[model samples]
Target: MPDFTATTPHIIPLVYQPDSAHWFALVRHLPHAVWLDSGRPQSTYGRFDIIAAAPQCLVETRGANTSIRYDDGRTDESALDPFYLLKKYLPADQLPEHSNSNLPFIGGALGYFAYDLGRRLETMPNLARNDIALPDMSVGIYPWAIIQDHQHKTACLVINTELGQRLGDAYNFLEIEQLCASAAKNPAFHEAINCIKSVQKSFKISEFESNLKVEEYQQALAKIHDYIRAGDCYQVNFAQRFSAEFSGDPLIAYLALRQALPSPFSGFMQLEAGSVLSLSPERFIQVRDKRVETKPIKGTIKRGATPEEDAANAEWLQNSLKNRAENVMIVDLLRNDLSKHCAQVRVPTLCELQTFANVHHLVSTVTGELTPNATALDLLRDAFPGGSITGAPKIRAMEIIEELEPTRRSLYCGSLGYISADGQMDTSIAIRTLVCDGDKIHCWGGGGIVADSETEQEYRESIAKVKVLMDTLEKEFGS
Candidate 1:
């Protein structure tokens, strides 16, 4: 097996900026561009934003098929496990240590691993319709990245020196350094600004349509209630999909949504098929220096109109017995998943109140140390699509989700983030996410269905979670 090892990254310092939206203009037009954005900018949860474009290689997996296409016209296809295939290229042992511990990613695989990819990992009955035929996994092996450190007020261009040496041309350190030096002076920024403004006025639709009607959603909730009573599963996370016709650049929509609803684990990826716009506040997993942590968000309540109302709403969520039970159930499931590749698995916090722009969430922190032989991908494979999104008994919950949900979840409830060459990894639950494919853009909102979960309350909660996102886009471009 050929290992694409990386040497110490060449970090070139650049001017600092709080809002990354302007800086992203530099690489927006590049092919296969990706931005792992900390949407909150300089806040506590928000610290780093990594942007990369024109990957050295692209890895895409659909069902049992995975193809790795390199920039030099080298292509390889295989039916191997996607995680095993990724391991061949991103083996954790090959990365060298660097002094810059503050930055999470220098150059590595940055993209989305779709929730449907779980089918490739576990044996489950095919029930949901595959209407949105997106690749289960699509990530680019980038050779260089532009990192924005919002907390320290610093920015830099980091080039993976070893990968650059092989790719040559624009990838070489000198060329990238020259590119960064001339970036600010380039005339493209003005054009990018104009392009964004023009695209913002392109939406023609007046409303979004959901996959499930109110009665249909209520019926699905009844089935979940039946399962809970019969001891089929303790809890199952159910969701509804909403879609609108979209024709213009999706970046305009992303920019609008992020501004209105800033989150810690937000990301945007431009792919060959379409684009992924995520504004997720939940961290599915993070691995650094062999230490692992997964933050699962289970409970939720919509934000109130006034300050007092907001506090009361948050307090209600924090004290909700049903929500707390739903949260702890998933926490236990994740603990078992982490233990498969980690040691001394522990839960540091449970059902802690964390408020986002649109909702109040009960977020819990689960931590552990990676077993000596385990890699980041190994940990990801064991945990798969995350327990919080799936449910308490993950396999059973996923089975129920498949049986009840009308259509396949292409990107929603999956994960979007990075696994750096330095062995550091972080990913979002891919909730509050939108997928722009073909002529339509799709979004989903859902919550856990416990025994006591009411049909009306669950339905209202689902819409409440993503109401801000839908409103923001529709307000900006009509629908």
Candidate 2:
């Protein structure tokens, strides 16, 4: 662990405020750069375009992160939790404050969390789907940052006193400004001049193929129904993945996906393990000022073809007993999880209808005040692999998921965000995500399964969740 004890912290300049999309084009070309965008009408944190090719340290776990307990059929040990690895390696840094400052990711780890990492926390009593192969966690350190504040129309560069020695570059304010100015004007990269289109109407639902055939899914859903009836579990969120081997340029696919569905929690991470492209709309957990909040999404309906149709769909979902019931189960699950480290727990909103480019979801917000000694890691450990993804009585639901699904969920349900050096953290539920490893690309979608969940309906719902990402890949590489 390299010491980054900055004697004095300082700020730099990014010159012109580069458009987030075009800037992303430039940043993604670099190594270990992550773009966390919450453009206007922000979702969680304000807009952040920060990268660290020259990290102070890097940590990724292999078979050592998680000790094997009950391996029903899994051969690989769980990799370390990237979030936990980051909290251990990086020193706590409360960023320098300013009236116009927007992002809290001053100097933190920029990486991802793999769904398989859960094996570290609990035993896999059932068989894993073994869907794909990828690292459980990977994070690059960034002791310096250049941020763009879209709301205020300004850009600022932040760094610690270790200054010029970190990246081995003799950098001054003027030089840093010139370097950014150059990146902004690079003619080869098209500038992301306007907002990403909010709606995409070209995709047809019939184009996607399911990992499990119709009859297969129906039989599986029946088994889950049996479990519910037997009092084995109340609700289980069973999910199946949709994937095809693709060799297209990942950046192009990401660009197309973002254009079709612009969102607040969207991110692009280029790591040695693989390329991560996420347009997630769900906020799993956020800790700031010792307060923890989670917004779990349980019920979903496809966005209608027209405005009237869309309104009708939203209205139906809002009032649907099944949808609301599905939502409340997860809310109860999360509330109980947070209670472990929280002094107080409250549900600010219940079964609220929220719209996205491709679908409408029933969401509920859960908030808790941290106990005296609770840290950000504590909040994540207490409530992770979010309740919405796993069903009510989380542990059993997860065990059922492993037995039924065909492959491990590498990153689909895991999170991708920053745990700030200052200790403020925000991460998404890892839905609407794509992982590119070599010539293959993996994506997953599913919904919570309750007593009344229909086999075909649940299958269609899972497909609907991943429709945007699948279509983007199809258009770019589906040929």
Candidate 3:
């Protein structure tokens, strides 16, 4: 294989199609920084279209020409280890690291390993080497590192075709603001929402049994546990069940869904056959001010119908010893991972439960200063798969995962985001995500399993977490 380094400026693009507009792109320069001023009107100081951050690292990549396919049957282990490859291409010493005192940049990069397929890789011809035609609408590549401001809207689209070039050159923050303003003034956004609602009316809920019987799954899980006992790995995330299928262009479904539910990490990526429509809200990793911080989400409890009930559930989750222990295990795991590349590592913030619109999570902040020789890539490699998903003693966990899980986890648990030419990087854990290929859609959800893990609760949590996506799909297409 060839070792390629990014020497020139790279433009990462993000494209999206609302109900009213044709596909549009958000473009920005890489390796830029964004400073968020919570109290200010415009809270941004970076050049990038979109930025997704993570609490810790969990991204992997198979190098060019090696055939260790994670999803497909092809298994070649020599594929560039994403962590190792990143270290060689983008080192920590060359990039800026964030500190606990300062804010950190966050983002993620997740998707099917299309690079493994020679034919698929051709479509996304590397811009670093050649000048290729871009879509009519394109956005800048997401900068990996930046300061996130919660006050102002910080979003961008990335373009990668002629259409993208035209849209990018004409589009800017001001233009986007105008578009959003106009969208808000008129009923376009609302109309789009209603359209999606109409489509969702047709969805029906159904369950299917796995062809591989429960015994098969049990055997897999047992092997995983055996590996765990053997100490070959620490925590391995295992998942089962391959479900969800449809007939139609996923892009259409993607457009409709975005209108109904707009997200900070909304993206439309062109791939083989069809494209991937992601509306993820999780950040995988963020680097800013020379300090690196990661927030791994471990626990989940559903929201209640009423405000009082919701608050009660959130409070209950916060005080749940079981959830807290799970969150803490990953927190400690992340601290040790970061310490590999930095000194003075600290877990100043322990398990603090945070709630989002959909579910509740036990979140903790881990911080560390990069050592003289460490690079962002080094930190990522040292802790490739975030512990929340894998469990403690990461390696053993992985072996367990391999044995328990029946299907290969392509982009479900991997990382997704961007890396800048300047060495700033950010990524997100690929959870609450959907991966589609033509008519087939694969979505995965699992929780950390300790010695005290309950098979039924764990099963329920996985199903509950996936309910949102399942419901969304049901609403889109009728049973």
Candidate 4:
């Protein structure tokens, strides 16, 4: 277990403007890059953007590498993680954490951990019938990176590989004056350079089809309540999916979605099979300086139009016994999960109602110290498919989810982010995530169900949770 503090990457500061347009133009066409932007001015990570690519290695799998999973419905477990897991691949060195430098991120593996990978950890069946035939997991190790800090208005382009090996006369290529002069000569680059703020180009696409009918969702919610009464599980998070086929640009759709609902964990990635557009607000797990933390969001409510009305709604949410109870359940579950790989597991805070642009969520913060022997893969195995999205009594809740949900979750409830060259990492709970599968797009949302949960209320809550993204998609593709 090596820490990144010992390794230092080649860092070159650039004359970066506080915008994504110019940055988007250069990397939009690059292969295997991750663009994680905190669209919101006020974000948890101080409004940072990271564009990393040029993967030296790629790893994709449906099952846990430690587990022996046969295609013919047979499987075995090894209680270990893949040797090539992101945790192991992070460079031995990292960028300085102090404010003196513009680099907020170190180069590392950037991609996603799909929700279906849960079956590999502990056997909970998956039919593996993917409509898009997308990989269960896709993570790449990018050797080059560009990191920006909006608040400080500074940026840097970092290369992990040597100048002679990867780029000829790399020092000359790393010069800001030379790059600026070259960009000034290009039309698109010049336009982006002059662009002042983030601008989204509107788009239009086809309508969508719901996998679960409104009535079907209500019925399923009621059945979940019945299961609760029968002592099967205390809480279960369930979801409904809406899918549509589109031939337009998904990156443009992602841009519109960001404008509509800017969240801290939102990101966009163009992969071989399709593109992943995410607008998630929940922070599943973040590790920095060798410390582990998880922010589990368990409650949701729509915002009100007036200040008085908004205050009333916030107060109502804070005082809601049902929502508060659900929030604590998942927090406790995460605490338990962290305990396996982390020492001194503790809950720093609980049930803080954080308001977003369109909705409010009861979020709780849990922190711990990762044990000396634990690796990043350990955290993924222990706390993955996030307790907030899955439910308390994690395994049992998943069983119920598998039986009720119509479509395979694919990347919906899974997570996406970076495992830095060192060990520092941050991943979102993959909520409000949209998968662009060829000409078809898929998205899902839902909530925790308790013993006294109301079917109609739960169904409505699920719809409200995803309304922002749905509206963005509709407007982007509206007739």
The per-model lDDT (C-alpha) reads: 0.85, 0.68, 0.48, 0.73
Displacement of the residue 198 alpha carbon in candidate 2, Å:
22
Rank the candidate models, highest lDDT first.
Answer: 1, 4, 2, 3
Question: What are the models' TM-scores?
Answer: 0.95, 0.84, 0.64, 0.86
Top lDDT prediction, candidate number: 1
What is residue 269's positional error in candidate 1, in angstroms?
0.6
Off by over 4 Å in 4: 1-6, 40-46, 63-88, 91-104, 127-129, 162-181, 184-190, 193-203
Give me the overall lDDT of model 2. Answer: 0.68
Q: How does model 1 fare in lDDT?
A: 0.85
Candidate 4 residue-wise lDDT, 31-150, digit = tens: 665788777454444377787654555667755444332213334444344433444455333322322223545566678888887776678876424575566778776656777778
Error of 4 at 182 (Å): 3.9
Over the full model, what C-alpha lDDT does candidate 3 score relative to the true structure? 0.48
lDDT, candidate 2, 86-186, per-residue tens: 55544433322221224565665666767666777787763665546566766555566666676566666666435334433443445434655686467
Of the two candidates 1 and 2, the one with more favorable TM-score, higher being better, is 1
Q: Return the number of clashes found in candidate 4.
A: 6
What is the clash count for each candidate, in the order shown? Answer: 0, 10, 92, 6
lDDT of 1 by residue, 1-479 (tens): 55655457878888776777766776778789898899856335878899888888889999889999887777899999988887765754622333245678867789999999999989989989998867999988887889998878899988886664444344534555676788667767545556676766665544788999999999999999999899999999999999998777888878888888988899999888799999999898898877789999999998889999999999999999999999999999999999999889999898999988888899999999887767788889889999999997899999999999999999898999998877789888999999988888899999999999989999999999999999888877784
Q: What tens digits encode model 3's per-residue C-alpha lDDT throughout 1-479?
A: 23322232223222222222221211111111111111111212122233221111222333343322211122333345444533332332445433212122222222322211221222222222111111111112222322222333233322212221221232233443344345445645555534434554343333323324556655655665566567665445556544665665454555555544444444444443434555544555565544677777776788788999998989998888877877887888888888888777777767676554467767777777767756665666556666667777765565455445655555556554554433455655656655565556666767776655556666667666666666666665645
